[model samples]
Target: MDRNTVEKRVRELNDLLNDYGHAYYVLDRPIVPDSVYDQHMQELLSIEAEHPDLIFPDSPTQRVGGEILAGFSKVVHEFPMLSLSNVFNEEDIRDFDRRVQAGAGHSITYICELKIDGLAVSLKYENGRFIQGSTRGDGTIGEEITANLKTIRAIPLKLTEPITIEVRGEAYMPKKTFMKLNEARDENGEEPFANPRNAAAGSLRQLDPKIAASRNLSVFIYGIGGDGSAYGQDSHSDSLDYLASLGFETNKQSKRCKTIDEVIDFIESWQARRQDLDYEIDGIVIKVDGYEDQEQLGFTAKSPRWATAYKFPAEEVHTKLLDIELSVGRTGVVTPTAILEPVRVAGTTVARASLHNEDLIREKDIRIGDAVIIRKAGDIIPEVVSVLVEQRTGDEMPYHMPDNCPVCDSELIRIEGEVALRCVNPQCPAQMKEALIHFVSRNAMNIEGIGERVVDQLYTSGLVHDVADLYCLTKEQLLSLERMGEKSATNLLTAIEASKANSLEKLLFGLGIRHVGEKAAHILSEEFSTMDEIAKADAEKLTSIHEIGEKVADAVITFFNNEDVLEVLAKLKSYGVNMDYKGRTRQEIPTEGPFAGKTVVLTGKLTILTRNEAKEQIEALGGKVSGSVSKKTDLVIAGEEAGSKLVKAQELGITVWNETELVDALGEKE
Candidate 1:
């Protein structure tokens, strides 16, 4: 076919596919058969492959995802994405209604929407074409995740009409998809996500857009970014309708309540029937319908007064406490898990609940074989609420935590100021296995193919023990393991080799140090510049660096001083692992700047700069930006409507500077 004919065919295919996708994914009404969709999709893919130049940005084939991102860039939201205040009980909901009525000076219509338990995101469009999508990071700033968002078929690449706008929504995973994901993770020996919300959030945050696409995430656009009036909408319900009309997915379950009583009834009905839904909803969001009324109500420092969320009470069920099992974590803390008789709670079957520690078990007087009342905290983690003493018989046996490690049989020791007993034996098999899993995790050494199951296989097979032993893995040894194919084994080894080139911070974080987290690892790497320097530094010198507290210092000292850790380090060095910091060195940071060597705390909202930008600027000038104001804070950069942190700074007599002063100090003109 000629170029013009090919172009026409491409356009025709795009329109047809997009319409079919919208009808199926967004509307949940399939307009075409699976075979028909696949045939069209294959034709489009073949055409795009043949004529790459003809592929449009909003082509249906682009939803498959493109290249992997190195990292997400920070995006400053044009308008802040404020959270809504929560109302728990009936009284709280009534009080919220009273407050809204008093603020508006009249009766109000409330638009009640399901408070989807997922990651909140802002989607931006220019001339009706999707431009960017981001998280609701601290309201004012977020990470750019446009590629991931584009992969979500429910999110329209182009609107029905050409218009520039920004909309807020909740990106979520369906319960069925979440269950499948967890099952896959379980099979792969990877940690399962706590809930559908976490799965959605985790999927979106992945650097690879393909991962997000595979997760089958969907979005429910709730409102416009700034105001509905800008779009010629008079009320929130109208905005929802307009959004839906624009090819956006808006929840159809949302109701326009004329009175607060109706709103309460809606919430009550949902609280009872929530389990029947395909996705998770934590609460019901009640918003004043009129834009004029919302303008009058305005917003507080954190949340909008015009709207509030009514959180559902946690669902509880009574189950027999069959037994209690203990597991040792990477840090050697033994956690107790209550094995309960299978019972359904919060839409999932609950077979086990976290008992937290020995103290919790004793405090609640929980015993094996006793009838216990349990509930899912935050609709995720199952916990024992109370023992049903009335239902319990004298046959129930009291439970006690063992003094020795169940796996290694080492005598457990309880440290001062700590409640849980720890297995101090560094050679404990359970600890070693957990540490190996942590070492290969995404944030650590990032050996992608090595999961918990692989670690267990290697450990049990006696081919690996410590993190350093991973470097010694042979392809022959891997091939001997169950489910290990030649290609997967080769890929695993390649990943392991690639990990050897990672900077010092990755190794430090992967070492499973007691209190040294990712941030602390980065800080230590930056301060010391080399693992050797960090190892040589005493506790006093380590603690002198800002953000490296005594706890981290002690942990570092303890880690380096250990003979076993030293042997592991030696082996790792022999494997030619990179030990130097790859990020900006300490010398690159301005040593004689205005904020040099000062511990600064940022408070409130800055109109000019986002929080991350300000924090980065402060760090560049050798200033440590802390999250909270304390005695150690030498300066507080207070912006518009600074709250309790500002008050605390004033009480501590710390020097305070406004945003203008901060900019001026940094030698930048406003």
Candidate 2:
């Protein structure tokens, strides 16, 4: 128990764990069962907790468990991981070949590789040992992911040669791992990721390396990083061999093509043969053979001129549509899903397909009992292809979306110029649960470990009927839930507590209003920093804000004026959640000025600043935000709901700003 003794034990444990980690992760062999590994890890954690000085910076325990970070730490790539420009058609390919041929003179060979649909990463080695790994952020700098990258066995710890070098490659989840992830998400009641690329991005971006390690990520090294030191190579294909011999896992399917025809052959072969693999391959990468040729062709600021990616078409399968069922979204928007007879496509069984909106359904003439073709759009989600009416049965049912909310029975209302019909009920159970979840999501309250299944459990148990009820949960309440232990309960509570301190903008987006979205919420947040201010503001007052057109203004006023809605907000306020934030309180602040370290969204038309200018100004200020109003939204700049976002902001009382106001504010801030 003494520090002196603990340090020795810690050293021993770190060595043991690191070796075992290497065996299990890098070698794909383990000398101990996971139980034993867990026991050892627990002992190490206990020892480290007892004597903090005993934990090493590179300890294995540091990789898997830790507090989620606010953002990823940036690392400058010693050699940039450049993006390949895309060549969509055969003419583009010939054009690329023409350029390469002109650059290298007479004849030019190419290296063709399957475009692994995942994030690009770079690994650096010094004195034969892996030193750092980073993402391809902006091609110049990326987030440091050494701990996560170390978990992949394909990534070598030590190179065969003692040369200091960097390797570029794709980090992907196996189709099998992606399956498990989807299953796990479904089991947890969380929305499944759209594709394996998303799964890899989410997993690898985790602040906790342990979470990344659990995802079973793999890597395939493709290019050798160019250091100023490599004065020797005349072409790019030669570098591939140098990297291949240096203990890196390069692609086996890569080909050295002497002509564009060969490149086309490689592309067509992979297009047909991609199904035989256990992973997803979206396209093919064609690169000029020589580094000299690549340089002669030169680079655009964003992509290399010598290389191009040719994407494959999505995989489609013809099958019989058995029935049509409508699944209600969290917003009470009923989406029609085609429940088809089971058909295999894209390495998994497909039984259901998205019908998009009613308009799309009508346009496609899709119906129950119709023969249809299904495709994994981009090899990700299932969608219906053209219906084979040539084989339709007389028993086929013509589908119609319900006019009322299935769960809340609220009359569905579609906004002007919008295709979606939505329930306006704030108290709707389905909406409430989904809203609460959105509120606590990473973009909103960002409560860690609180996923969809856990949200479902709270709602099902009646412990959480609304957003305010989540704050009322105690350790005992959480621990009593399935799979929630004491430590988990404490952590969940801590995350929830932390979320309460988030800026008002996030809260506004998470409220699940019909029309308000992220951009509108940002606008609203800056206009009324406090929920009280927004709640008290009338439709006219709301509309007075820039971009708050009549449609959006009316929706906002309707949401706040509801009695039940007022009650919920009052309860949430009483529960100690901050209904106000500092960002929105100042009118003199920039409408478009970089809300440095703050997130903002723009919706509708801005009278003061153009949309692009507003976005640019925000980015310039070091503030980051995106489209789609969700819990993650920091502010919404609304010219109008332009749709659901306007209503959402009013319900949540997020700040609203007109385009002119935003443009003027942004200019003034700088």
**Predicted model with the maximum lDDT:** 1
Model 2 TM-score is: 0.54
In model 1, the Cα lDDT at residue 179 comes to 92
* TM-score for all models, in order of appearance: 0.62, 0.54
Supply candidate 2's per-residue lDDT for 544: 83
Give the alpha-carbon lDDT of every model.
0.89, 0.76
Q: Tell me how far the alpha carbon of residue 521 in candidate 1 is from the true structure, in angstroms, after superposition.
A: 1.7
> How many residue pairs of model 1 clash at the backbone?
0
lDDT of 2: 0.76
Candidate 2 worst ten-residue window by lDDT = 226-235
